[model samples]
Target chain A: MSDPGTITDSGSSGEAPVTMLATPIRLDYQYTAGLSQSRFLQGIAQGKFIGQRCPACHKVYVPPRGSCPTDGVATTDPVELSNSGTVTTYCVVNVPFQGQSIEIPYICAQILLDGANIAFMGLIQELPATDVRMGMRVEAVWLPKDQWGLTMASVKYFRPNGEPDADYETFKEYL
Target chain B: MADSEVLRAPHVLEYPYVRSVGPVIGAFLTGLRDGRILGAQSRDAQGKATVIVPPTEYDPVTSADVGALVEVGQSGVVTTWSWAPEPKKDQPLDRPFAWVLVRLDGATTAMLHVVDAGSLDAMSSGMRVTARWRPAAERVGRVQDIECFVPEAANP
Candidate 1:
């Protein structure tokens, strides 16, 4: 085959030479968390887990949102959620990326919290990577209260609780 | 609730890519690096000569290749402005300033930049303003090389 670079140069005869410049454009923004999410974060800071329930469908949502995705109605009911949950699915992370805080070969799992309809992702720790299973029971291992603030970072990571693996029937719909 | 505190968080958006400025825009940025401003020479629909700042490779109205590069005056007239009471992050100025559209002395079209007038009452259309270049060491081949614009009298 002819050289790949020469095939793309057919239009260069009439055009002027071009030069590329590199520049870094940095922008920062402050986002205001609205009513529903603000309440959830405040609860996390106080070592309490809060979720909102959809008024029509009654689906409990952790990390509460203003409106329900399923019924498209306002989620006005606030519900307290247990810190313990079942690991519905997980992935073994071996690849590296910029701004990644965790070490390689860690398990990132989707946790279906008790009393909530939706699942959220978090780092799974305090267990061997190979031992992490699809139906493992886990609980939020929180950081010291002095280190807590308005962030979910207060929960360092989720660890496997001594409870037995949740039955497949319990989290089948969540997958 | 009015009494409830609003929660805030920081977000950063970044584009990690390298771009080619092409011949016309490359020339303009090079001029900025050397402490000068260049405009593109073009013809309007009426075939009259015009110059545009932050030069474009093709004329915006006529869609024809710009004819030549011309050096333009540093001072200009503020054609319009809006007050930014609380400047957002990464804007040209950190303090309260005016976002202005200025028509340089020799250019027909306007360019956008911030003016560091102390207060909103100090800014108005038809005000004379001059480009304020960043220090020589901080000069990069980019539009931001000119840190901001200041009132002509304030610069002197």
Candidate 2:
């Protein structure tokens, strides 16, 4: 038998290089509540906006809270809310998130409802993206009356009220 | 983009939140076990008086220690507001509703909260509101213990 350890290069050959590949991953978060946010979820199941009040300051908070920002004590009362509001400031959500419901290039807006003082975040719908603007009067679109639940998704999205567009100066402060 | 041979694991990160409170906050929590609301004063800082639920022991801007802690009423007015058309897992009102900035009767500035009204007609600036407390059995040291505010009276 020939020598077991023998170098056999198949004629003329040069060294070859090595390479590696990678993939891009996105972030997805699922939240669980011990207590505070649970009330917000409860309200959504029934189709309502909830807020907490600071007993020290007497300020009512939307997305009702467990703790008051001022007094630091847990608020006791739970208040229900109206669904209508005005657009305060907003950004067009031309981009899309994984598992998103609305189509890409939709609008994500900040709306200031008539009675509440603070702003909550959410999406707008039913109207063309170009038609959305700050101070535009919009109304909530419920999830087909029977399908309501304890979540913000209870209201499908906001729709245009057909009023003339609000002046930019009127809502610039909210941005 | 698709490749049959590709295999990868996603990167994940978690961070802890560290919060420090001054004297007012300490007293405010003391009040919670007893069920009370306290607001701190801006002795060195000039501004309208405001109520603090958690009782900020120190002025946010001046960083001065607020010595005087006082009780606040449960009613207030909407200073400014916004709506959350959709809520995530644990917002106060699971349904669509507005978030408002409320300035209590004696306070100068505002705090945040949610309101429950069926439509825009149900809400307005200066609308009076009251706190809806959670049951005592559910009381924890946290904020959501109060729940969300509802309209005091039906809108005309």
Candidate 2's C-alpha runs over 4 A off are: A1-30, A96-101, A162-175, B1-156
lDDT (CA) per prediction = 0.85, 0.62
Q: Write the per-residue lDDT of candidate 2 for residues B43-101, one digit (tens) a residue.
A: 44555554444446456666765545666666778877787778776568878777988
DockQ of each: 0.25, 0.01
Instruction: Estimate, for each residue in A21-100, the C-alpha lDDT of model 2 and write its tens digit.
Output: 12234344544442446666667677777766677776666775678876788865766667777788888877766568
What's the C-alpha lDDT at position B19 in model 1? 91
lDDT of 1 by residue, A21-90 (tens): 7766666889888888898898899987899999888999988878999899989789999989999999
Name the 10 consecutive residues with the lowest summed lDDT in model 1 chain B: B1-10
User: How close to the true structure is residue A90 of candidate 2, measured as C-alpha lDDT?
Assistant: 82
- CAPRI verdict (incorrect, acceptable, medium, high) for model 2: incorrect
Quote the lDDT for A158 in model 2: 80
